[model samples]
Target chain A: MYIIGELINGMYRNVREALAERDASAIKTLARRQVEAGADALDVNCGPLSKDPVQDMRWLVEAIQSEVAVPLCLDSTKQAVIEEGLKACRGKAIINSTTADTDKLDAYLALALKHRASLIALTVDKKGVPQDKERRLELAAFILERAAGAGLDAAELYLDPVLLPVNVAQNQLEDILRVIGDFKLLTTPAVKSVVGLSNISQGSKNRSIINRTFLVMAQAAGLEAAILDPLDQELMRSLITGALILNKAIYCDSYIEAYLKSKLKS
Target chain B: MAEELKMITTWSQAVCEMRLGAGRQEGGSRKVTLTVGGEETLPFLFKEGALPHTPLIAVEIFDVPQDDEPEALRRDLRGISKDPVTWAKAMVEDIGADLVCVKLAGIHPDGANTSAGQAVNLVTKILGAVDRPLIVLGCGEAGRDNEVLPLVSEATKGERLLFGDAVQENYKTLTAACIADGHNIIAESPIDVNIAKQLNILISDLGMPLDRIIINPTIGALGYGLEYAYSIMERARNAALSGDRMLAMPFICFVGQESWRAKEAKVPASESPAWGDQRERGIMWEVVTAMSCLQAGADILTMRHPQAIKIVKSEIQELMKKAQS
Candidate 1:
């Protein structure tokens, strides 16, 4: 599974203050912690609250790259901010988001092609987030068509079905779960699927439990990647256990320990 | 539109190479050395990965004469079997066996009851008889093998001899001796992956690096549960390639011993007219067992019959050439 550590963002208190005071150490610490917790990449967002997102994106990219060698998920709603973040990335990066709207999809598709970076496209279009599996598939078709038109293969595309808070959209969870497997069949080599792991329990009382439960269930539904808080010990352990259960990795007596040791190295 | 069908090239993380025998400068008195393992993919899969070293064959020559031995085994070595040294020389000079496996059956208490000192003397004479690498095997008895094999291991201290029959109960003694004597070990398990892994874990716990240890997940001849043996070996190889360090070493199969034990190899034509000639049937039994094991990733095959060994050796040559490109 591909894990994008969702910790270094302006929405978080520490990251917010770090960006305000230009404290690179704070960003570095968060970057190091997530990578140590088995994050294949770190999702960095300037948040909607940033007065100058392009500059903040550049600074966040440089700070995280300076501290850790992992790839950065250049996350932003603005095309310019994502472009600026891409410029500062030293290695392969993931463009955090593009929705299914024609103009938005076209711009991100061009950037993805030029930078040769993977893209994570949300199922919601300009009309708004889909509430049913059919609408989700419709948006997915548009995004995948636009991506392929620009010569981006299935491997370079990650389709997210736009997770919503479980307390409000309880029925949508099943809808998303039902379509996760179908997402893989949409292309020849199989397009990758990811979910914003914490979105399911955004306001729930049992946040950690809900997140861990949904992550494993999503995995069984062919969700091969996630934007999650890697530092959540229970959630990370659950991910490893789920992988073993899926027969994705060979099991040994010391499998968890072995997994962590290899994670630390990578 | 015509879609071109292309093959996929997958790779294993690592393939460890095990060297047997030491020359003058390295340690042994042999004129040449033998190497096995170091294959990156499934055996004989040229499209997938590498076949670094061709599988080596060592002829099994026993220390004592077998008056009641199977007729097929006794046919060629009948007279030479009187002495270990003569039989060993014949295997290397006549049959061109890569190495001579000296099975010290005479030392087993259940049979000849030969002393450990006598076993050492036989090994010394056999080493002098041939310039090829020698593998010293123990009788199946655990207590007796543990006792005699270590002494034999110590006697051939610098030859880097690959000694075996190191079962779960008897591995510590042999591993410790190999650690001290600068030789190698063959850890034998009873055709089970768990026991095979446990045996490897035990040997590794004794500070014997895996590269110095070859695994013998016991075999079953064709029509004699050979599939069970194949399945166990395939799983071990897969686990090893996926980073199970304990199982990443080379594998050795006792083809001659297991194949000859089957009734079909020696079943009388009078009893079953369709069974065919005893000699040809027996040789084919060993050949098929070796070939099936090779496909399942055996790095070394030890056989008793000269004709079977010759066939397997030439097959290994052709296989290696076909896989190189």
Candidate 2:
């Protein structure tokens, strides 16, 4: 139920326009809404698409932190973007990524250690997103080893198994969940796990419905964090309810107060 | 009397565990949260073992004109039907609903030709007007949902919303937004047990928790293949309870959509004498679908029709009572 409000990213046309025009109002609106809605952290992704990702991510992070108290999940594939995002972050932030690839892992882990930022590790290596759970687990194990060598705490590491669309491979989903279930046995107990929420519903009709249902299932499989849009009420409610059932929260009693406050601010 | 009862053989459990509530002391807002797992003790085993949580019932509200709806139900929603916000508000205030499920049918590419921003604005308006938990449903169009959900996610941000109808294809953008924005997701598969399990697996592949996922095995109305869906969900739940981790998340059924779409719910009274009164039939249609889903292991049932909601809620109360006793 740790909602990471994803509105500040520059991927959408509106956000892109706002970022390009330096429209602080639009950016501020998104930031405030996400915080109010229920996002625990705001993921700031100033990808290469932005004019200056480093500077833009830094500015976006600062702007969001000023208005909302939620932590930031700094997202970028570039080492430079991770560095700048880390530098700009006010409190402890989450590095949006690192791959199992040795070279990439070396760089990203260094940055995470340097800034004491939590890391989102992708279970993919020199080969792109794996097609099966075995490969995913192999890569995840490799990444975990490298992370351990780098002296990163298990709790600070979040593993992303990489959800592939079912249309491509019917069994692809089964493989992925198997890996998640196996991760409990494979990795240390303290290690956290998460996923980029969009991958499973790729190319399907009724995408939102499919995405939300899968998110609930993933939560069942022990996924802790998700890279998703924090604004959808249906998705948010599912997250709240799902977290309560999992006993992830204090006493499973915060629904009414939290929901009301979210609406009031909105 | 001293003889030990033998354990009954059952299908292997395949349900997954889903977690809710992220970043509390770890740094976000919100004092408390909850998560439900997809696990089942043995599909519909109310008498045999513990059913940790009772199924939740959600009331459905649509953004489209219901000219086709029966006069009885329409009368109750006369003024509200004109506006989505009013209708949603009524679902909460007048209907005693647990969750408000707003279907953005008007924004589908095939329907209103609305833009993503328009859909976002409509959802925002509705959210602004209600305090209860919300479930935003997209028209079952993959491309259109991708177009609208991200914006909707951006618009709602952090309300801990549940967005849906995510299928095997076209889930990336919306799923990404849900993950980024900290919302829950619904993984919908065709009415097949394997397919349901597969979708859950794929979503978890992205590092999303099973607790954050809800499985929709695809619903069917009373006669239009209800038994098929029922059996499939039953099998899936049995698998979860039997220890299969993939199918463990709580189940959701689009009762309103499935039941309302049937000919029985839509056809006029004169046209089908065998069906009897259209209002009674329609309400029964929804109630029967909702009840069947509950029997098959539905954690949350999204329904239309006030009568249907009332009946299902009471039925759920009775079931809970029996279980507690």
Candidate 3:
């Protein structure tokens, strides 16, 4: 599993204070910790409170890149902010998202090709996140069609079904799971799939348990990546166990420890 | 024109490379060192992946002569020398074995009951007599191996000997000794796949890296459950190529020990006239067992008869050749 650490975002209290004070050291330390905790990449977000989203995105990308060699996932709604983050990245960066809208697809694809970065496109168009599996797959197919037209390698694209909170949209959870697997069939050597795992536990009493359970279920459905808190030991262990059950990883008595050590080497 | 379909499977991981016997520049006395493993594809599918090294043959020598040893093997041993040092030298010099495997069977409680000091003295003498890379294995009894392996491992510290037969139930002491003395270990698992993986993990957990370990999947003689052993080895190679890190180490098979123990190899010609000459049949048995192991991903083969070693070694050269495509 490609785990993008979600702890570096400014939405967290410590990250918010670090962004306010422009404490690059705090951002650097968080980046290193996540990488040590087995994150394949880190998600750099400026949060909703950033007065200067473009500048803050660039700063976060630079700070994290300086501390760890892992790629940064430039998380932002605005194309300009993500583009700024991409320019500062010393290595390939991930464009957090775009929608199925033709205009947005055109803009993001151009940025992705120009920077040679992977793009994560959500299965949501101008109408907003779909509540059913069929609509979500339709949006994913549309995004992929645009990518093909632009001559983008299907492997460079990650499709997120935009999962809603289980507390409010309990009926849509199963549909989202199906959507994740269907995205792979949309192409040969199927397109990768990812999810912002915290979205499922939003407004839940037992957030950790809900998030862990959903992550494993999505993994069984062949989700390729996740933006999650790598420091969550129980959640990380569950992810490792899920991969083992799927035969994606070798089983050992100390498999979790083995995975962690392998991360350090790579 | 009809469209042709081509399917190519890609592997994300390859078996880890392990070098046996360190040379003078690397702080050991051996004149030769062999590097094994590092195959990205299954054995000899060169069109798919690189096979960096050919499989090796290690002639097995016992510290003490076996009373029940078949006459075919006894004839071969009589031509050479039964003494450990002279036998190791003849195996390397005359027999042309790529490596020498000294089986310290005399140290077993049921056998001559030799002391650890005697085993260590014999290992050091053989290391001096033969400059080839060495593989030192203990008696099958875990209790005695646990006692004898540490002393022998410490005696040949920088020689980089491959000490083994460390099983799931008794690996802690041998693994620690190998680690402390800077030697490689052979992890023995019965025909079961899960136990093979588990033993490797247990050995590695004691601060021993996976690259310094080889898996002994415990094979059977040809026609004596060889197909079952073949399946396990093939499954292990498939798992390794499919990215199972713990199962990715190179395999070592004791072809001579298993093949010779079969009644078919030991019966006299007068007893079974239809079975043909006992010596030739026994040699062919070892050769056939060794050949099957090579195809099933054996990086190292331990054999007894000189004629069988020559046949298996020549066959390895033939199999290592890649197709023109």
List the candidate numbers ranked by DockQ, top first. Answer: 3, 1, 2
Q: Rank the candidates by lDDT, best first.
A: 3, 1, 2
- Top candidate by TM-score: 3
Candidate 1, superposed: residue stretches over 4 Å from native: A3-92, A229-237, A249-266, B1-15, B19-31, B63-68, B102-137, B140-189, B194-215, B235-249, B268-274
lDDT of 3 by residue, A1-266 (tens): 99999998878889989998999999999999899998999999999889999899988888888889998899999888998999999997999999889999999999999999999999898797797889998888899899999988998999999878998899999999888888888999899999999999999898999999999999999999999999999999999989889976656677787667656754
Query: Which is better, 1 or 3, measured by lDDT?
Result: 3
- What local lDDT does model 3 show for residue B150? 93
Tens digit of lDDT per residue, candidate 3, span B1-325? Answer: 2233244568878998999999998888999889999989887777677889899999988998889999988886895656778888887888789999999999999999999999989988888888888899998898899889999999898878899989988999999999999899999988988788888878878989989999999999998989999999998889888767778899999999999999889998999999999999999999999999988999999999999998898888877754333
lDDT of 2 by residue, A1-266 (tens): 45666667787778788778777778778988877766667888865588788788877887777777667899888888878878878798998888888998988888888898888898987768898778887888888899899999887888888877767666787677667777777764646678777767789888777779888988888777787876787887787677657744322133433333323321
For model 3, give the TM-score of chain B.
0.96
Best by DockQ: 3
Count the clashes in each prediction. 1, 135, 0
Compute each candidate's TM-score over C-alphas.
Answer: 0.81, 0.51, 0.94
Candidate lDDT values, in order: 0.86, 0.74, 0.89
DockQ values, each candidate: 0.16, 0.01, 0.39
